[model samples]
Target: MALNPPSPTPSMFRKKKSSSSLGPMSTAASYLSAVRAADARARARGDTPLTTPALSLSSSVTTSSEDTILDEGEESYSDILTYPSIPPTSEQVYTTVHSEFGHCSNEEYRAVSQHPAGKPVAPHVEQDPPYYVLFTTYISYIILILFGHLRDFSRKYFNPGEFKHLVPHDGYAPITSDFDSFYTRRLKGRMDDCFSYPVTGVAGRTIVLLERESKDSNRTFAPTGRKVRTLNISSYNYLGFAQARGGCADAVEECIKRYGVSACGTRVEGGSLDLHSQAEGLVANFVGQEDALLCSMGFATNSTIIPALVGKGCLVISDELNHASIRFGVRVSGANVRMFKHNDMKDLEDLLKEVISQGQPKTHRPWKKILLIVEGLFSMEGTMTNLPSILELKKKYKFYLFVDEAHSIGALGPHGRGVSDYFGVNPRSIDILMGTFTKSFGAAGGYISGSRVIVDRLRVRSHSHTYAEAMTPPVLTQVIASMASIMGVTPALPTSTSTGTITKSRMPEPEVPEAYPGRALSSSLPTWMDLPPAMREGTEGRDRLRRLVFNSRYLFRGLKKLGFIVYGHDDSPIIPLLIFNPGKMSMFHRLMRQYSTPIVVVVVAYPATPLVTSRVRFCVSASHTKEDIDTVLRASDYVGDVLDLKHSDGERWPLERIMNSAVELVQMEQPSHD
Candidate 1:
């Protein structure tokens, strides 16, 4: 119009405000023409044409030369297009370009360029074109190569053939060589199988709150949202101290404040604190030993210390029913180990005599030392060791004796001094006195007490002493406080005794009162029966032990009267009820849950015991009242009858009934013969 300026370039026209007023097809045509022209210009400048595809436009949309110029009536086109619009800053341009290529941000591209593996950008090159475009393209190619290799590797190795051997094969190897295979195949669906239940609340002698197993679970037992509260008769809270709150808890809290929790390192490093030494001294004095060494765990005390004490030239004769810790310890000791029948003094003596006569293996040389290891109380069988008989054999054979008082300590004897005090055998007769604080002490860790030489040697030689972290301050303090309560006096200094032959003293049975009719009070008395009457009258350790014995007898009698076959001694707190049939065992467990008054008891079976010899075990505590014991007894009788677990009137097991009948008939015939 008024000598109009040369028409604006197509690129400028594409950005004009009038372009927004165009139809969709016209707008597409304009964009396509602008992109084509830009590519042509780039090619004319000796650069590669833009590789990005141009926008496609419909054939009906057309643009003429007249459309490129604006009319004078529309005002100056340059005035509108050349207005001072803000230009994008470097950060804004980088962000916009990065987003177009699916990159997270420009910072990410810069980070890659700085990497040692990435290509360096030349100073002459622009920042946007080189760093982001090149690095992203390089990363994508590398990822594709890696994915190709991964696919190839998966095809070659992760195939069915790789795992074919795990299935059954017609080979010489037995199908069930180990427990894992055996449990997988044979015992797969037996849901109520023993030893997997998770208990809640206090695992005390009487009451326990536990989550019930869900009936819907198939592969494994799972706890339900609902909880069952019942009388607990399965725990090993021997002296009712597992949940002690008064003194034990107080002592632990005080030490926690002072030490601030863990010892932080191994005993040989920074873990050994003043509390550890004081606790060790207390344990040694209580056990009447010259010195004692403490370890963080009860089981490791035996498992590790045994190897440190003896080697290949030595012989270790172990009790068949000794704790698993002792069995494992003997295996690790590298000594010639021999096992005698459980609690059989004659079998032990014969084995000892034979080994002594035979001497060492192969070379037939005399053994460097012979060690006898036994437990003060057998946990599984609920029986105490024949300490007097074992001591006599040790004397004649000239062997060292190791006593594990895990169950008996703080639970047996007049002063809770363990088997030596229970049987009136001198403590000096035992070479090594090993006991745990877990059971009756209501604490964690174990102590190995003996002569100064043995204790010092173990501290230096035992791997646990050098490497394992020392017992935590709180646990050590708990043990110290609980032990003080049990002893009824402060922990005194250990006194040295002559190693000369100790005179044996037999424990006399307590005189039963004639007031109670048709009952021998001595039959229900505990090992603390020999405690002084003055001490027994008080609410001391002896009274607590006596209450435990009374509860045990009550439960034992109730089970027997209900026609249930019970195991263990009358005065023993652990009571076992036989349920030989696996089906009946599972049924008994279920029925107990369903009973009006539900009761919780432990069921022991295969692996823990021999196959088909599953039994329901009950542990009576001083905490258990007569009402609690009665409730469990009544529930057991009902469940036993419902499951047909009770023995028939004339049907004793293993030919006992037939043998008795034959004896009666022979006696009648004898009268006719006379």
Candidate 2:
């Protein structure tokens, strides 16, 4: 009668396990009272000595091995995930597999997510690597280019057959110009192994990667028929909502049972569902917006919606490092575009002033409107946009502000409401709030939230809404459940461990009044969505937010203390450690994967980042335990020394010492030598 995972089905997803002993879903002996009876039995039987849920309940990716249940009698594996340093006592209980969700009971590990009152938000610092590392990185690319040219030279003479694609036949244009693909053939082609490795199962705390090998230098690959399980630190699974089980998953499963897989057509073409409205309403509430609309795809949410906001006569001032989708949309919109240095408020103000003073290019006529676009959290650099400063600029310049919170929503803020919540500013101050559910909600699609007028306008004008498929019922359910968990629900039910109502205000001082939107009400969720006690009370959601911040700070600061050049704000869930040398990107990845406890990492080089600043980005999740962070720190320390990547000018801490003083390190102001 418990909510354990069902046995695996031939299909990708398995249905939730139901015991034969329990009454039927449709009460055999009652009327509309069927649902009430089922729910009553569920809630009453769920009453237990444990107050808090053993597993974290945020959005997440997949279940481990078809959501495997923890067998109390089975002997634990030697793996760190299975047999953690401090195993749970026999008296304690667990509902999750250790590989999927690391067990951490130490409440002391938690930290609140909020800026100190009256103090300025900490500025993002980019620690530069050693000059020699930069030189070598350039040399590595130069050597690859030289070899590529030499290969082309030899092939043209001795192996002319392979060069036919670049030569025109019968007056038809060649397949593609050789020069057009020079970078891909010369540079990226060599290290395709480190990128896009095949993976399976839930992308939770751990991920299962399918093994493949290539003999012709990554031109093609053949599966080795082997699967490797590795510690997952590369997914956008902030808050660990990328789960295949727990409240979120259960809700999704129920949704699939009631509502089929697809929405059948585009939103405007008779494809919208009641769940669409439900999700839109919850999303609007979550981001503190008046109303919101959903796009079937995250990329389209920006690429399609931006065109509806601005056109030929308008001006778009965007962060230079803004996502490509934004640039594409701006170009398509035919808007006059201006670029500003990433997250640099001074550069932004200068650009804004120049655009205002200059007016429309050449015509010297005033622009119809000016729109400034910035990401709430930079995915690669992990820099939080200067919201407070931008709001001040918004007041002075009177430009429409559109913040893309694709990476920040449900991952930042004390309440997990996103950047506006994180920065202690009113969400409505900004003209538009755009976010995607993929990052933190562990679901697909995106949303654009703002005043009702703006949202209603986009629905009619945006290409995605008019053409693309509406979001499916399952994804919408995941969004609603995960978001509700984060916002918390009303008509609370007390738990065995409950000690009065939970306080969400984590401000250092009490008198300052709440600076962000408050919790969600019961009416915000659907009448059918029945969340467990912990999620109902917002306890699990609160725990996940605190856990994420703790891990984020620990990883960012820990790498710096290990004498590595780590980029981004310490509170950022996305932590990038500089790899510098392009060649070592593959080496670092392979070495980490080959560790005693295999760790999967994502490596980025030129194009995504500067050539000299190639880095391995580690996305922290609440699913990770404190010990898991220690494991990553230890792995990086060993790998850094081997690859000579530790080049920052800082007091380096010993690996053992770093592991021992983690809680102290997370609590301290980052970059402090102590």
Candidate 3:
């Protein structure tokens, strides 16, 4: 009987090509028909493949065409594509055991090794068993260690979930080691309270666009589906200088040409350029001082200038409501510091008396100096300094006066010459005049304009001034240009005062004609009094200060006549129709969205302002015309009626109630040093 062959079993791996064959011409025809049919169906369905099923058997193959795949060894083209298949498993080699004579034995081999039926045999090794086992274990252990390290690295560097667990959330302190647990805990609490209040979720009413087809053009936010840009405020471009006379563009161009890009190093190093000197010169001339020293920043101007001017033997008497920058600078100076009550002349006199009393003792330094520090204007409450009173006390105490004219420099005094001019105090009387270029000049940097001796002393002695990066060439250049443009054209103060001191006799009656021309008596005097008291307080005060206040009055009357309970003041441009609760800010913001004109709010919160003071600050700009202001007032009135601020006391806070509440709120916001 003939030996039978074993049947083939299916293998795990599948081959891409089949080994079966067909009659030559018939196979080619059948493949062509199949591919053509496929192409027709794909075309009908709008499907396209990268490579066509057509095969080129021509010797001169065109490999450039993507739709054709060329095959080797054929003389003509064919529709079918072919690939060779693997041989059967039976054809592969298998290890087998045989007799020493190299022949299979009929009887089962029983000598040294046994060959089992239907199985392959391995070749025997001559090496020692222990050596082989040791090598195998070494290789396997190394592979496992490598795999473990790879898993650890991936978890540390690339796993998003693992990284998220490592970071701290907004309210919490990051997991850093700390030396002071109490301090860290307190800081974390403050941060949490500040962030917890929600400002974004307030409902905003859609502003009706005056454009005829605006309804279809309105866009909704993607995530929350809310409309943004309903009302906007909180911008620092005071005096609208950014848009003044191509000022912004000129600044940018100058900055680019001189500095190229960055100040490369600190002021003492590569940063100081010739433009810086030009700016310093201009500032000194404008302030009517002999010389000036420039610094990289305004904060540094205060922090560095104060500490340098007052040290071990000096005393600094500060106004209690002074700007935070001034307070911090005083603290850092390590001087014997005392604070007087806000704008209280009596309190200031008492403090000076105590300083003078102590200074008279023989044990103390004989040449001691007391520096009185105060701001020209209080930023938050819009209050101003009693310069006449302070100057009177200064004459008695012989203390040096250092006033921060930060807010007042750009907005107060005749031609904005600042507080010295406003109160008719000579720049020489102040001893040292420090101002920043960032504000009215529309640039950055600061300078101390004063007697040459004081400025020269500070130039070398100030720590940050000596060590910090200097102002950029372009920024300094722009500052110089702006000073030249504004100060050069600004009319000068009448000069040659015949030596009269400030007294009660010179004080004008409150109801004197609002517009007082010839306020500056002489052309020789570089500084003259400008801002009157009424300009800083109440309804009449605001009206005297700005045109916006007038518009606000018109708006208020219109709104009142229209029967809306409008909140806040017509005297002050910052009017807010009070919404009693947190829930109402959203509704107020929403109604504001429906107006054609924008009425932005300056939002205040728990940490920034008191909860009671948590209302929008509606600011009227000088840029707004009477018509524009009227439109805004009408819209606000309409919205106020809709929100129902008229009936509730919370909605309409009286001016006195508002002022008292403001004072209390300020007290609360201040940090308790004790």
Lowest lDDT sum, 10 consecutive residues, model 2, at 20-29
Off by over 4 Å in 1: 1-179, 192-194, 205-217, 221-223, 262-271, 490-540, 648-674
Against the hidden reference, what TM-scores do the models get?
Answer: 0.62, 0.83, 0.50
lDDT of each: 0.57, 0.76, 0.46
For residue 209, model 1's alpha carbon misses the true position, in angstroms, by 4.4
Error of 1 at 645 (Å): 3.4
lDDT of 1 by residue, 95-126 (tens): 11111111111111110000111222111110
For residues 1-674, could you state the per-residue lDDT of candidate 2 as single tens digits?
Answer: 22222222121112223221112222111311232343344445553211112221112224433233333321221111132334323222132334556655566788876766456655565767667777778888889889999988988899887778888877877899887577788789888988899998789887878878999999999987767767799999998888655778778777777766554333536656788887887788778888899988999999999999999999999999899989999999999999998778888899888889989978989999999999988888888888888899999999999999999998888888888888778899989999999988899999999999999899899998888877877888888898888877766333344358854442232222122366666656676778876777787788899999999999988998899888788788999888888889988999888765678999998888987888999999998878678768877887887888888886888887887898898888643110
* Residue-wise C-alpha lDDT for candidate 3, range 249-296, written one tens digit per residue: 344454565456656333446445555655665566667677788887
Q: What ranking of all candidate models by TM-score puts the best one first? A: 2, 1, 3
10 residues in a row with least lDDT, candidate 3: 93-102
User: Alpha carbon lDDT of residue 329, candidate 2?
Assistant: 94
